[model samples]
Target: MADLTDRGTEVGPGEFAPWPLLTMHLGGHPLDQAQLQQLLAWELANPERAAAWGITPANGPGQLQERLDWLQALAPRHGDLPLPPAPLEQCLPLYWQLWLPLALTLKQARDELNRPLIQGVLGVQGTGKTTLTLILQHLLEGMGYRAVGLSIDDLYKTYRDRQQLVQADPRLRWRGPPGTHDIDLGLTTLAHIRTAAAGEAVALPRFDKSLHGGQGDRSDPEWVRDVDILLFEGWFLGARPIDPSGFDRAPAPILTEADRQFARDMNAQLATYLPLWDCLDRLMVLCPADYRLSKQWRKAAEHQMKALGKDGMSDAIIDEFVDYFWRALHPELFIDSLKRDGEHVDLVVEIDRDRIPRAIYSPALAMI
Candidate 1:
């Protein structure tokens, strides 16, 4: 049997911190009392939340446990262990409640469609989108399905093009906010991924943030063929244009007539990207409990970087940086309404300040 940490020996209790299953069998080992208890705990974690994810039907526990077992059997060898040393206490609930079920849901959807499934994920920075994508990619690949990740950041206009854009409109100093991406390029890439036959190579663009003194640029292309699932995610992905009148009583950082004008203009830019959103088969939103948590999280990160003697922005600068984005597309004006939108959005995973997901539900079903 393979050891949890590649030690080649059976791990005893207290070997892996926070991994409470100190005695549970692993590596295809049959279930013991500990394993059964953990499974029941996860299956009944939250009746409403589990049901929303389609994990609580009459026969759902049987099906759900199979998925959980699939995850447990795969964990020791899943490349997520032995190197980065993830504490099971911090990660296990999420793995059981979120990643396993989401991955299996995508697999079922892809199998039903008989073609590539494009999933759109929306979340601000520090919402665990990267971790989610990594686990999803490995799990699907382990099952022989090719799961590729394509971030909206990869679709930004070339550095030269963005320079020209900033020159024409000095207000556009940043790459986020609407009007920064190459919509035609994104359309072409998604179309090709959807139409390509098996064994056909599709070139996906990549970006390097370290280029041009920290202003990012397109670096290279990763070529892939016959993609089974495409994990498309971005800070603003799946965001749609809202009515401009909402900006009248806009939130702070959006004060002054100048800020209001910029907000309205960026709001208009969203309309041009509707075609890209149309390509998504399903959309999931990772919403923060309080949107201001982004600023706190950013400052905390910069402090850590500076502590290590790396260049970091000061708290005031972080405030300015975060506020600039809010002035462009305030989350209150966009995400707050989007989370309740049943027509467009499919899933909403609400997270607390600690960033652990608190609730999972389908806007459409909840509305019904």
Candidate 2:
């Protein structure tokens, strides 16, 4: 075993201790004591590195070590405590790449999503909605706010129940749309979180997408969280009614004229949930540049599923499946409603057809 103390020397004034530098890089691995020492040593030798990270040298080695200890303690609780592959110096640029702009936007929108308010984020499939929810939870927690994420998908009806419905209708291929979920159960959970006694534990529903439905395992550890900020995100979260004429401009061709009529019919059916939007304190829309980009993201997600040793649909099949929903939902419903009712739609982050985010919407100037 390598002695961590022998690998690195401390530098900087006694008040600000330099972080260590490591020779052996652990890519995608958790930081061990040896690696941690090396990083400390590198920081000591290059004090300017600390400045770049916004880390002040005012805290001596002991304080720096204490910070590391705190992070280590937080790791297991968060699960899979993996460190960034790049060196601290190299990682700084990546942080600024996304975090800087998002930080500025977040600062402007922070009050809307943080503290005593319920934030609802809505987006179509493959919009990175879940990932953004997790990121928001992490960021909010870091800022000393207690935040939790709950999805409507979790409250899905049981597998057998949903299977029967799908088998009966055939049109209900996916159990993700509004009627497939248990709205009453979801509303109850949210009510509990909002009005329940402090420290109360409530059962939360869990969705098992691999099984195409949910399991009755109510004992999952995520249930009954005591949180200050609750973020509810899902597909069709803020979906509303739209005029039938909006479908005239859709680019994707249907099988026949009747198929086009069916698409318009489905949009009209979702009108029942328009009232749900009033429950949200704020709404943010993650608009991808185009359907093609959304399809690419779906492919990437399928690939990730395969990498995780899970069974997944092929790219072509996934694209076809997503297209069916987009053709029915996007042009006739979501896009038209957002464009028409600008007040309720707080922000629309423009994503290209390739699924790359180009710019964000500014309601003040009405530009992306």
Candidate 3:
């Protein structure tokens, strides 16, 4: 109920109230209202010292009065607005706080733009990769840099084509894995964006979670070229070719008897796509803390989908689907990718199994 404009300066309708300006010691935390008032009272009592500190009697009194008034107004509102349950706020901060360093590094890279740069973000399901990409887009735009987000999921070949692969091998439940996507379309789109041509538009496909197929009408196309940045993000964006020799030793639980055979067959077909990572300017892996955390995050993601009105996906279904890829989803493989390709991948922030920051990986430091 406090009005911001009553003190000579006019505030627009629905404008937020001005916050108080109270400075503490150079390296100290901000002063609370009581401390600020005590300081102001002490300063006013000693005019000679206040003047020596560059506080003129006329303006100093007015500024101190404004600070007192703003504090009085802020108190009631601060008490009225509900604070989040402490635990929720605690975990929530961990979600974004862990990524701040990586975000800062990426922002710095964007600032040093000499040529076009394409940044790819890699994560398994529910690792917040898409959300991170959206956050990056927002931050880049805030910094006066242009960024376009394109998900590999959006380039899945026609629904009809994907369905055939699933039908051909019932083991392939969802059309998300490597061979199921339209690699040709994805590569072509990336090439178009890279070359800086105008009038070239590529229609990106959209997935329909309710029907477990394409939405039929949701396709995003970039008509104009010369885009500064393209954020290509997906579950397996940086997945390397599974060395055939390692397949024999892969855990049996990771692949069912049928899935093991299917993976072997599919890997042969996916050989062509292995070189796609070479085209990336940089690869960023959002490595989960561990398999357990990854699974929990995946389940939480499924619940979020339900809240958003998506159907055909329940916790049970998510659990079952996750089981199929458990064997193939290796954090070690990702770690190796970061080690071998550290130069091409500017930064890797290793999150713990608890989703807390473990260490940061950079080419110069290797591990920080």
Highest TM-score model number: 1
- Please report, in order, the local distance difference test score of every candidate based on alpha carbons: 0.79, 0.56, 0.55
True-structure lDDT of candidate 3: 0.55
lDDT of 2 by residue, 1-368 (tens): 00012112323466332222211121234456655554555554544334323334454344345444433333333332122233333322212222233333343354655434566777777776776677566655654566677786777777777778778767766666555666667767766766656777766567656553333322243765556766788777777767677666655645566656757766776765555567666676766656456677778767888999998889878877877776557643575467445667665555554333445543433532
Q: After superposition, how far is residue 100 of candidate 2 from its true place, in Å?
A: 6.8
How would you encode candidate 1's per-residue C-alpha lDDT over 1-368 as one tens digit per residue? Answer: 00113121224785432234422434345566555555556555666566667765466647656765776666665445322555443455566566677888899889999999999999887676766777688878766789999999999999999999999999999888899899999999999999998899999989898899989999889999989999999888889988899989899989899999999999999999999999999999987888988888888878889999999999999888889989998988899888998898888988877666678888887876
- Runs of candidate 2 exceeding 4 Å displacement: 1-115, 212-221, 253-255, 304-310, 331-333, 352-357, 364-368
Q: Evaluate candidate 1 by giving its C-alpha RMSD to the native, one decimal.
A: 5.5
- Lowest-lDDT window of 10 residues in candidate 2? 1-10
Per-residue CA lDDT of model 3 for 164-246, tens digit only, reads 77788776656666676777777777776776645445443455443543323234454544466778888777666666655
Q: How far in Å is the alpha carbon of 300 misplaced in model 3? A: 2.7
Q: Rank the candidates by TM-score, best first.
A: 1, 2, 3
Cand. 2 TM to true fold:
0.65
User: Per-candidate TM vs. native?
Assistant: 0.88, 0.65, 0.64
Candidate 3: stretches off by over 4 Å: 1-104, 107-113, 197-226, 255-257, 303-312, 327-344, 363-368
RMSD after CA superposition, every candidate = 5.5, 10.9, 13.5
